[model samples]
Target: MTLDPNTLLAILAMAAATVLTRVSGLVLIHFVTIGANQKRALEAIPPAVLMAVIAPTALVTGPAETLAALATALAAMRLPLLAAVATGVLVVAVGRAVIRV
Candidate 1:
């Protein structure tokens, strides 16, 4: 299979679309003055977006994996964010090792 001119053009169009959608937020945010309630809503959005992304994956994982994730989140709460991620990864790795033995 080869990427011909038509295929290349399609790819370029898709890339442009994606870039525009992402940048649209920055453009709007720069020009628009959001009110107090809107600002609060915007602040809340990140956590809600994070939960939306994580909640499904967490629910689908096995019990041990879920426990490991919880441990990681708790650890993260106590330490820096990166440290928390590392702790969670370590927990999952150790849990898997113990299970396999």
Candidate 2:
């Protein structure tokens, strides 16, 4: 299949924007003096963003996603972030397979 030129240009533009945003964040961080509380708040942003994205899906979607999200939350209480996320993915996969969602 042939790639559309407009699609390719859009993809490239998106990639460039993502890179620029990240680079700017890194550069700005080096110049800025962040206090302990600020740093902690900044660190919380990723997980907050992740939950903001997933929570809607879990709530609106069927039982499988909700179960998986619950499992992930429980796992996150005990496990590291990455491990907890993995547990969530595994739960979702198995839930879908078992429940046939």
Candidate 3:
């Protein structure tokens, strides 16, 4: 199957945009000096973004997802991030199997 010219152009445009975004962030960081508070806020961004993405799905989805998100939060209190995420995945799988939802 031949790739349509528009599809190829769109793909190339997206790739360029992604690279430009990442490179711009790096360049900005290189020129900027961050203080302690700013650094702390920056460090918090990943978890905030993760929760922002997960919270809506957990709330909007069925019981299994909600239960799994709860489990993940509880696990996160004691475990590392990776383990907490794994706990969520495991809980969600089991919840879905048992609840059939």
Candidate 4:
């Protein structure tokens, strides 16, 4: 498969935009003074972003996904991050296979 000139340009443009946003974040961060609240907000941002992406899908899909998310959250509190993720994935896969939902 080959990309034509327009498609190639579009891909490059998107990549440049993505890089700009990331680099700008780093640059802008240097100007900001992070106090306790700001630090907490920064830490919360990732999980909030993750939940924003996942919650809609899970809610719309069914109970299996919801349960899997709950399991992931609980496991994440204690297990290593990767293990927690694996546990969530495994639970969802098994639940889907057995429950047929």
Strongest candidate by lDDT: 3
- Which of 2 and 4 is the better model by TM-score? 4
Local accuracy of candidate 4 as per-residue lDDT tens digits, 32-68: 8889998998899999999899889987887778878
Relative to the true structure, how large is the alpha-carbon lDDT of every model?
Answer: 0.82, 0.94, 0.95, 0.89
In model 2, the number of clashes is 0
Please identify which of the two predictions, 1 or 3, would achieve the higher lDDT against the true structure. Answer: 3
Query: Candidate 1 at 78: error in angstroms?
Result: 3.9
Candidate 2 wrong stretches, greater than 4 Å: 1-16, 81-101
Candidate 3 off by > 4 Å = 89-101
User: How do these models rank on TM-score, best leading?
Assistant: 3, 4, 1, 2
By summed lDDT, which 10 consecutive residues of candidate 4 come out lowest?
92-101
TM-score between model 3 and native: 0.75
Using Cα atoms with residue i matched to residue i, what is each candidate's TM-score against the true structure? 0.68, 0.65, 0.75, 0.70
Per-residue lDDT value at 8 in model 4: 92
Name the candidate, 2 or 3, with the larger TM-score value: 3
What lDDT tens digits, residue by residue, belong to model 3 across residues 47-97? 899889989989999999999999999999899989999999999999999
Ranking by lDDT: 3, 2, 4, 1
Better of 2 and 4 by lDDT: 2
Candidate 4, which segments miss by more than 4 Å at Cα?
Answer: 1-16, 97-101
lDDT of 1 by residue, 7-97 (tens): 8999999999999999998888899988999999989898679868886787687755776778876896689888988888888888788
